[model samples]
Target: MAVDMKTIEHLCSLSKLSYDEEGMEKVMGEMGSIIDLMDEIKSFDLAYDDTKDGNEIRFADTREDVPEESFPTEKLLANAENTDGCYVVPKVVE
Candidate 1:
């Protein structure tokens, strides 16, 4: 599979990346090497068993659902610099 300039440009655009001609060429080369490695791996066949029936996978017991507790309004409001009933941070956007 040939890695063309258009394909590289499209990939960069999707990633919101800015690259000059040299950077683009370098990225294209790296991508080409990766694709080549994948192609090589595709030609190999391994008959490895992935069965997990007998193996015990230990995991922590999940937390049980409990009644939710609400914090006091006065306590919560005290933490806010500018509060009607909630915490307020600096305005980030217009």
Candidate 2:
């Protein structure tokens, strides 16, 4: 697909952007290059084995969730700068 001035103008209008002739030309060139790259990528013959089992398509090894002991509330609150039985943080909103 060719990136033309009309298309650039339309895109700029939609984005509420104002570009000079030189900037428009630069953007058009970049867009054209991107489109050409996409076309090249689209023409590639990517083949994958479809006979593989669904269970064998694991990207990472899964681990079982094991319950562990946790620290007491008093122990956790001991590290807080200011706590009224809970953590104290700065007021975020008015």
Q: RMSD for all candidates, in order, please.
A: 6.9, 9.1
Collision pairs in model 2 = none
Q: Estimated TM-score per prediction?
A: 0.45, 0.40
- In model 1, where do residues sit more than 4 Å from their true spots? 45-60, 65-94
TM-score of 2: 0.40
Each candidate's lDDT (Cα)?
0.81, 0.86
Candidate 1, residue 11: how far the Cα is off, in Å? 2.1
lDDT per residue as tens, model 1, 1-94:
6588899899888999978989988888889888877898776797657684556555556565797889888897896789866677888986
Candidate 2's residue-wise lDDT over 15-52, tens digit each?
Answer: 99978989988999998888888898777787766776
Best by lDDT: 2
Predicted structure with the largest TM-score when compared to the true one: 1
